[model samples]
Target chain A: MSDLVNVSYLAVGPEILLTLGAVLVLMIDVFRQPSARVHAWIVAATILAATVVTWFQWDRVTGEGPFLAFSDMVVIDEYGVIASFILLLVGALGLAVAWGMVERLGRRGAEGIVLVFMAIAGFQFMAVSANLVMMFMGLEIASISLYVLAGITRERPEADEAALKYFLLGSFASAVFIYGVALAFAGTGGVSVYDIGAFLRGSVLLKPGVLLIGMALLITGLAFKLSAAPFHVWAPDTYQGSPAGIVGFMAAGAKVGAFAGLGRIVITAFPLYEAEWAVGLAILATISIATGTLLAIAQSDIRRLLAYSGVAHAGFILTGLTAGEAGMPAVWFYLAVYTVQLIGAFAVVAAVAGPTAAGSPMSDYEGLSRRSPFLAAVLALFMLAMSGVPLTAGFVGKFGAFAVAWRADFEWLVIVALVASVAGFFFYLRVIVLMYMREPAVAEAPGTMRARLEPVGALRWVLIISTAITLAFGIYPTPLLDLLSTALPF
Target chain B: MTELVLFFIFGALALVGGLTVVAARNPVHSAMGLMLTLFSLAVFYVVQAAHFVAAVQVIVYAGAVMTLFLFVIMLIGVDKAENLSETIRLQRPLVVLVGLTVVVVGVFVAVGGRFAWITGVVGAGPEVNGTAEAIGDDLFTTWLLPFEATSLLLIIASAGALALAFFRPRRREGKEEGAP
Candidate 1:
């Protein structure tokens, strides 16, 4: 309960910037009749500004004593900065891909952009949160906005269904997470991660029963968010049913936030009991990988296929967690690379289908190469990256995750992941095959059903940038690895 | 002796209220049972010297949150009868097994020294614990960031509600705007 308030202001500059940006966008949307493009530019500028603020915090974050603010409810650290930076990048890319959605929604598009900023701010808060209650608040903020965003196309019944399902399941998960925090508080008489860690370390309990249950519950709630199997039933439906434009942001931002929070909980709070939680996490990871790979093979819709792919990727990320403190950098790297590829793939999906549309069947992508070579090539590239092909970001990500897990003595889990990686090629390659090998269908009416690419200038930029990053990281990942090496949770 | 008697009476009331919630046929009756359970829980909190929590339980949970639940139920057509039959064949047996296991585990832990630590006060027992003044001081100082963040969370929620529920989508032109 320090008396200094100004330090807290400096610590939370990025979040403040995002919150003000969100408010400003909403205000402008209400007062001014600006084009959707204007709103997009404003959103992009806000994200860039937040990024700059995050950059300035880097020096302060990595400084001696690792600056904390608001009675240690928030911390400025390399871990939070890197995670927040990725989340903001994801937001910017998601907004770019959502350009068609903005134009399509017209006046109502500002609401979408506002929700995006709110979601990003929420996730950024999760990354920096020092207190358990603050973490829960951040999770709720992000998840609530995502649920509403999932149902943004109110005209579509599928969107309504997606929003309702996500809201119901997501609220239940949040309650479980908060209940775990309450139990942890009761067990240790502490709420902040630092306090809890000190308490756990100082105590020698004959029975550490309640705390273990709390940790298990905490992991379960985050596992649900990560879309790990056994709690992954909501993902495919939500991803397939929600509007195509913002699904990438929803999926990627949630992973970055949840992983950041979960990593903090496990590494910061539960290191003493690593043997117990790592075994449990390993089992969950194996299940998610196996289930995601096997089920993705049978998917008809491309969105559902990607949903399962996301599930497998979640398993890959959790493998990094099994390495305890040592695996964090790999976790960050994998999330950064995979999320960009995910958003890029979805950007292509939005380009082929209208942004607001939900379902995009596999047949819709047939002969995409002839229709638009650029879009088809980008989709294929992302698919190759997603499949962990050599000389792609996904390959390096998979290698880093597996290498860390193996070093942590989770060899059997690594073996399972290796098998799953081979299985992943089937579905990802199927999309590529549909795009390249198949022929475009003839229209019944003169030329009504012809394959014509949308004039999505923003999506093209997103594709180009994501593709370049994917390739660059794949070839020379030393810089990203170096940057992530310093991102240690305090 | 009087304290023990009060505990028994309130405890029995809470158990009955919980049973009523599960046994009631009507949704409104179930809601009433839930309120009874909540009120008895508030009494428990008060007995533990958590007066602030007790007041918040009554005001926020029983008063405001329950009202919202009832409003949603009414708005969504509470007149519609719900199916009481089990959808899954093994649901009843599974519920019974889980309930028995929970009760057994609860009794086991309660008989042990686990619950003893819960109320083991080092210095003060009841006077300063969970008082409004103590909570308010902590909220304003120790939890200042979370408090402000909570205000921002509320803003996001209200905005989400406005976007999702209030704003109506405009109809498009003749072009159905199918797959691009």
Candidate 2:
């Protein structure tokens, strides 16, 4: 029992450090009014320290296999560790990419950094927790922080609108999630994922009416978070209206956490009902792909376009899950590559549109190549990768997802995804064309000069790292694939 | 017979309160209706022998949350009536249809003779007494992680409120002066 207790502390070491770092940052900001740069340094140092702790936890999990901690409320496993790594990476990249906006916010910048730290810790808890109530707590913590971050630049009415819509819809989803938890408890008399699974495996229910409804509600709530189409109405408005710099992080971090939670709930806890849920997930994937691709073509704003594309990508990720546990490797790979590409693409948006700007009209990109060759090149690369062009990480991710879904007898979903992928190429390529082929709109107006666009400070590093990852993973994905193959829930 | 009578009375109160919350024109009246529903819920909890939960329902829902709601209403000013015109075509009909579907499904479940839906081994877990001691023991021991995690949620809520509501006076003045 003592050993178990120690392991539990070890399992949560990163979250503890992160929460302390958040409080420390807030305290330091209150006492000493420092530059946003100092807050960034503190946040970076905290993330680095947390990463080291996660490394140790990873070593222990890989050596000793997965173990339950804190009376099975938390699980220390490779799957959770990998998800944590992705979320941490997102936090770091998100902070760096949005550094310009943080600095622009002046004194409120520290609050932004602290919220990022708290949000990362919350999502990390979500990834690791094995109990339903614990997961819900983590979800709310992360969600409320994101809701605040959405409107951190309160000067913009659009930002306030985005925040209000997200808060209202997100709270409703959380309530639904807790309702599902209640129904599941009533049905199975257990709240721990493994315990519920054990109970289901041990008994055969003649009438699974309440349990089925509970599972459906749980999936619906998570589907809303994942922004799988039909539940994806809030994504476009929120992404378009929130400050451009941090939208990447918001989208990427939420997806990673939601997918991690969904994967565990479906693959670990409800595998007994896989036949039912897989079909349901496949139907959702089909609709998401179709809707995202079709609607993206109609969007004039770049942010709204990416938001729609993200919905389609969510569908592709869901397609992999239809293959059950065997498809997790593909899902992880797709998530990692896609999230980096997303951040990199939005980094360019931040550079071009100004970090605190809410909208990025496609017209803003007219002749971007002349304004800034580097930004245009990287953005185009991200676009190509997002559209799943050959020799890009996006292609490999989609291929892997489609392959798994095909093997799972979801061949029709694979087909629909392929057609959507082809259609997706249009909007992505249109961006490339506008950047490269068109003349600057300002150039046409005499006596007007459009300043050269350049990525400065942390945004430069974000682009470089994201681009490198996209290219390297595209050329060789073996290492990531091998690592993810070991990332199975225990 | 007394228990049934109490249940019916509180249930009626809850329904009325719920309808008023949706139908009342005055925001303050809606808040009061919400308080009524919450109080009725506490009564139900007490009737179920969940005295600890009943107290928490009254204290947290009726006392604290209702105060927060009223404060928001006061801050926003309750004089203006909310617009009830439909912004989307057929929204009212769609909502009614959805609500009807939920009611029908709930009724079917309740009267469908499926009360034995729970299939897990009975009494395999900790026993519940609905007392503070039993709840505290479970919360601290078996549910320690979730309980501890709730602290993070509270921290987030407070921090988020501060971040959104607390603006620096200098920036506010600058913005005001800069405005045309």
Candidate 3:
């Protein structure tokens, strides 16, 4: 029993720090002066500590069997470690980037910081979930937090509308997810995955009555999370309505948690139904690739454009899901690439501000090549990386993703991939031409243009780090691949 | 037997209340409909043996989320005239979208999601601790990293929400109201 207690403490120690820190930050902000900006740095430090702790566990880790502690509900494994680490790092980046971005807004409400911590914790819950109940709880935590974040601007009806839509859809999807879990429970008479797995090998549901219905519901829930085609209607509006920094974090960090969590669910629970679900995933991949790229071409709003681009990126990630046994590691590596590149793009976009100036506009980027070549060049690097240009992380990530599809004998998907990649290049390059070739909307005070257009110190560093990592991984992706390969037992 | 009864009752309430929320003419009435739907959902949680979730559903959702909705409705000052949509985009047909989505999800399943391995994961177990304690153990132990890491996301959500609330970037001019 003492041994069990030790194991539990060892695993959850990082979460304890985070939860306590988040609650404390909120309480302190309430009692102390509202203007106290103490929690940003403190939150940053606490997350950093948690990351260090997670890392320490990584080093001292001895392989152990995945267990269902607490009456057999959840499992702990290397996959959880890898996914959680990414979440921590990204969440910390969210705070770090927001430090400047929020200050730029000049409304110092620490509760906003507190809410983000809660959302991150909620997403982490999804990543580690085993039972449907846990999954539902985590989904609510993430979704509700997102709805509030989406509509926080009371004056903007568009923001309000976006929140309402996201909320309504989220609740609807939650219901669908729960109903699926219920159907699964009906088939198995038990709520545990282990019990379900045992029953599925040859159960009454296996005869194709109730069990089949249950599986479809489960996949639907996961699809909404992945933002794969058909279920992806909410992506553009939600991202466009959200604040730029939040959209960026949601794009990268949220996907990392959701995809990893969903991947675990698919692989662990539904391997027997691969033939049935795999085809659906394949169709989603094709449509997601084609539709995501084509629709992005029609967009004028920059945020909306990125949001659509995310849809296409999700398609590429879905290819990993369809690659069957061989593509799992690629899924992991590709997600990491997608996260970094997105953060870099949004960071550069966010950094386009002056002391008293309004938010960044596309027109502000006109002729940026002449004003500050560095910013232009940074944006260019991120765009190029997104386009899967050689020597950038996007290339290797795409290659890794498609290679899995190839291994699955879906070579046509590769052709579709090539077509999508070629098609995607135009939109990404449009940004380049706009910055370098087009002229700024208005001439700036000579040095003012340069100073104003400069990147935030922290965000600039973040972008630089992300850029370096993208390049490094592009040039040498084996390290990431090796890490992902070792992180899961598949 | 009691569990089944509770499930049936909540399921009936949820179905009827959900329908009412969608069909009601008055926005406040719709909000009330939403409340009933939420309450039914709480009862559903109880039937599932998720006592903690049921409590949260009542407190956080039915109590807090519903109250927040009521407050928003009041602040917006909805009346008979305002409840009506002025544009063609928000006509009655939009109601069908929800039913359509459910059907689509159903079709995906009815067709077996077109994969064999996805036949469905079913299990048999000696269930214990229901939902709360089991989840508590699971979350605190093996799943601790992901659970803790979720805080970072909450931080992002909070910052984003706050920025939206305070920044008030003008959609057209990029400046706030009355600001030079």
Stretches off by above 4 angstroms in model 3 are A1-7, A31-40, A60-68, A105-109, A152-162, A202-204, A353-361, A446-452, B1-16, B27-79, B83-180
Please provide the root mean square deviation of candidate 1 (C-alpha atoms, Å): 3.5
lDDT of 3 by residue, A46-138 (tens): 787778877665654535445444334345566666777878877776666655645544444465556566667677666666666666666
- Place model 3 in a CAPRI quality band: incorrect
TM (chain A), candidate 3: 0.92
Instruction: Give me the overall lDDT of model 3.
Output: 0.70
Q: For each candidate, what is chain B's TM-score?
A: 0.74, 0.80, 0.70
Candidate 2, residues A1-490, lDDT tens digits: the string is 4444434677898899899888888899889988876787788889999999999999999888887898888998999999999999998999999999888887778788878888888888888989888888888988889999998888788999999888888889999889898888878888889988998998887767788788888888888888898999999999988998899999999999989888988888888999999999999999999999999999999999999999999999999999999999999999999999999999998998889889899999999999899999999999999999988899999999999999999989999999999999999999999999999887644344467878998999999999999999999989999999988777
User: Looking at candidate 3, what is the lDDT of residue A256?
Assistant: 81
TM-score of chain B of 2: 0.80
**lDDT tens readout by residue for model 1, A110-214:** 777778888898898899998898899889889988998999888888999999999899999998899899778767777889988887788765556677767
- DockQ for model 2 equals 0.51
Q: Model 1, B1-180: lDDT tens per residue?
A: 865787888889888889998998877777888898899989988887789999999999999989988888778886788899998899999999989997887677667644433311235544657889989887888778778887677767767777776655444532355522
Q: How displaced is residue A92 in candidate 3, in Å?
A: 2.5
Model 3 complex DockQ against the native? 0.19
Q: Looking at the true structure's interface, with contacts defined as alpha carbon pairs within 8 Å between chains A and B, what fraction does model 3 recover?
A: 0.13
**Cα error of candidate 3 at position A142, Å:** 2.9
Candidate 1 interface RMSD (Å): 3.4
lDDT of 3 at A285: 80
